[model samples]
Target: MGGLSDRFWNGAAAQLVNAIIAAVNARDFDALERYATADLLFCDSRGGQISGLARVIDWLRDVIAADPSFALQVDAVTSSNGSALVTGTTVSRFFPEARRTLWRLTFSGGRVSEWRRYSADPLPVPPPLTAH
Candidate 1:
């Protein structure tokens, strides 16, 4: 049963990762909004202070707009206790560099309640953000 639960959770995490990559790459704000909790919290290592769903949406929009060259591809996903860890790599169109990243996500009512992004390789920073 534990294995079953683990597989289920890991699968869910992978699904969410796919949706996130697709939504963000496609610039589909509606999909992103639908997958989020009203009080969704995104904490990246980039160093910033913010709250509210609108702010999150704006932050995402800003990131997408600021770095069109950035792309993320999930390599693996593992989950336990309603939390999932995603191992991925960030690729860029213009730059020849690829950076590894790990994302931790907690779920509430099937939506992402909290999201944390960490740099796996080096320099734990997200793509780019325009200060608002």
Candidate 2:
């Protein structure tokens, strides 16, 4: 029964990752809050660690407002026993040189308890304009 429950949690955690991406893309901070625990910890790519929903909401709001083209793409997810890790890439127009970010999420009670993210690779530069 424990194994079955673990599997179920793993799947749910994976889905939560997608939900988070969608919320960010939509700039829906309120909806994103639904997936977080009260004491959630967020470790950003810039080496900043912030805790709690209000802080997270403020951070996300600032981020979204600063970069109108910010977008996230989930690449993969894995989970076991009350925790999950998600890998993904984030793209933003504001800092195009450092846009590709990989994220890892940890879950507890079907809510995100911790999130750590960093760039998996150097962000790509847009090609120079070509004469048509």
Please provide, for model 2 over 61-118, each residue's C-alpha lDDT reduced to its tens digit, 9 standing for 90 to 100. Answer: 7766666776787778887766666666667775545355567777777788887777
Evaluate residue 125 in candidate 1 and report its C-alpha lDDT on the 0 to 100 scale: 32
Question: TM-score for every candidate vs. truth?
Answer: 0.80, 0.77
lDDT against the true structure, per candidate, is 0.72, 0.70
For model 1, which pairs clash?
A: none
What would you estimate as the lDDT of candidate 2?
Answer: 0.70
RMSD of 1: 3.9
lDDT of 1 by residue, 1-132 (tens): 387777887788778867876776787878988887888777766644345557777877766566676677788888888877888877765345888788887888888888877864322234345376
Q: What value does the lDDT take at residue 59 in candidate 2?
A: 72
Off by over 4 Å in 2: 1-6, 95-100, 120-132
